[model samples]
Target: MPSYYDIDAILTDSQKVPCTFEITVPGLGYLDGNPGEPIKEGTKVELPLWLGEMLAVTQNNTNTPTLSLDLPQCLSARVVNALKADPRVVDIRALAPHFYALGSRMLELFDEEELLDVLTDTFKRRAKEIADQAHHPRGVLGEGAEFLRGLDESERQLFRSAHESSKAVRNWMVDLKK
Candidate 1:
C-alpha cells in the first residue's frame, strides 16, 4: 500500500481507468459531465483510479458491484507490446509520469501474469540503462539525452542517486589521494 501523503501515490491514483456502470447510479452523471442526470447502466466512463476502484468493489443494493474497471489506456496492449519488443525505446514518462507506481496499483486489482512479467522485465532493463547513463560522464549535449528524458519519475530518481553516488565516490578517491 502506498503512503497516504505520498505525492507519487496520489498522482498514480489520479490516473484514469475505463469503467462501465454495472447498475444505474442516480445523480452520478456528473462523472460524465451531466450534473442533473443519472448515469445509466452499462455507460462507459473514464474515472480516476481511486474512484473507479472504490465503485468497483462497493456492492449495490442488489449485492452486485456498482461498476467494473478496465485497464487504463496507458497499459493497453500496444504499450505492452512495445515494452516487450524494446523496453528501452518506449517513452513511459509520456504514457504516465508514475508508470511503475500505476502498474503496481493495477496489479492489486488485476491478476494478469503477463503484465507482471513484462513490467518486471521492463524495469530491470531500464534500471540497468539508467545506471549506465548515470555512471557515464555524458555532457548535457551528449548521447542518451532522449532516453533520460523518457525516464519516468522513479527512474529519474534512480538516475539521480546513481549519478550522485558516482560523484561522491570520485570525490572520496580524490580526498584519499590528497
Candidate 2:
C-alpha cells in the first residue's frame, strides 16, 4: 500500500524549531547545538525538536522539551501563500500532515485562532483542488491519487466533501456510459 503521510517533511519541519530540555542521565552524547562536549546529566540545553524527541524517547529521563513558538506563523503564511499561488503544482499531500501537526501545536501553544483558521482554510482549498484532480488525473495528481488513497482517517476528512462530489460525478458518468 502507498504511504500517504510524508515522513520526511514531518521530520524536516520538526527540526526547524528548537526546544530546551534538561538531561537527567549522564553520557548521552553531544547536544545538537553544543557539539564536541558530551551532554552531562542535569545539564539544560537547547536542541531541535526532532533530536529532542529522539533523546527523550531513548533516555526516558530527560524533561519534556518545551516547544518554542518561533516559526509556526511564518511557516503557516508560507504554506498558505504557496497553496494560493498554485494548488496543482504544490504537493499538498506531502505537506498536509506536517502543516496539520504544526498548526495543532501552534493552536495549543498560543491559541491563535485567526492564524489557524487561515491555515485550515488554505489547506481545505488545496485539498479540494487535489480532490478535483483525483477525479481527472493530471500532473502530480496522477500519482497523488494513489497517495490520497493512503490518507489516514483524519487527513482524509479534509477532502471528504470533495471526494463525495467526485463520487457523485463518477457515478453519473458510469450511468451515462450504461
Candidate 3:
C-alpha cells in the first residue's frame, strides 16, 4: 500500500508573512479519537502505507499547506456507520431471559503451519537473492568493475576499501540480507 495525505490551509489573525497557514496530514493512522481535533468527514483511513506516506507528503508541503495530523472526527452519521460495519464487530443485542449458547471450536481451524510456510518462503527467497548477488558481484568502477565478486557480509555494517569502491557492489547484495 502507498501512503497518502491531504493538505489544508487555516486562516488565522497573525502579524507574520501570511495569516493563513498550510496544514498537511497523513490520511491513515491509528486514528486515536481525542478531544478537539479535526477529522476529514468522510475519509476512510487505511493502514500500513498511511503513516510513512503522510510524513513524506507533509515534508513536501513545507510551511504553507502545513500538515494537520491525526485530526479527530466530528459527530456525524458517516462516522457511526463506519464503526457499525467494521468486519470484526458484533452488535450488542439486548433481550430479557436470554441464555448463552455453547461456543464453537472455530479457533482450532486456523492454519498456523501454512502461515509460517508462506513467511519462511518469502524470507528464503530474499536471502537467496542476496547470496547470489554476493557470489556474482557488480560495481561501478567500470562496466566490468572488480567489486564484491566473492564477498558476503557478516555484520550489518558494511565496510569496503576506498580504493575498491567498484568492489563494493557485494554490499548492495549483502544489504538484502539485513
Better of 1 and 3 by TM-score: 1
Q: Give the residue spans of candidate 1 off by over 4 A.
A: none
Q: List per-prediction Cα lDDT, in the order shown.
A: 0.93, 0.53, 0.28
Candidate 3 total steric clashes: 9
Which one is best on lDDT? 1
Candidate with the greatest TM-score versus the true structure? 1
- Candidate 3, residues 7-73, lDDT tens digits: the string is 1101110101101113423442234253245433343332222332343245442443333223112
lDDT value, residue 94 of candidate 3 = 15
All candidates: TM-score: 0.97, 0.46, 0.22
Expressed as tens digits, the lDDT of each residue in 1-178 for candidate 1 is: 6689999999999999899999998899998888989999999999999999999999977999999999988899999999999999999999999999999999999999999999999999999999999999587778898899899999999999999999999999999999
TM-score order, best first, reads: 1, 2, 3
lDDT of 2 at 56: 45
Ten residues in sequence with the least summed lDDT for candidate 1: 137-146
Compared with the true structure, what per-residue lDDT tens digits does model 2 show for residues 72-170?
Answer: 333556766665665445544455345556555545546676667666776566566556665565554565666565443355665566667878989
After superposition, the stretches of candidate 2 with alpha carbons farther than 4 Å from their true spots are 1-16, 20-29, 32-69, 72-97, 139-178
How many residue pairs clash in each candidate at the backbone level?
A: 0, 0, 9
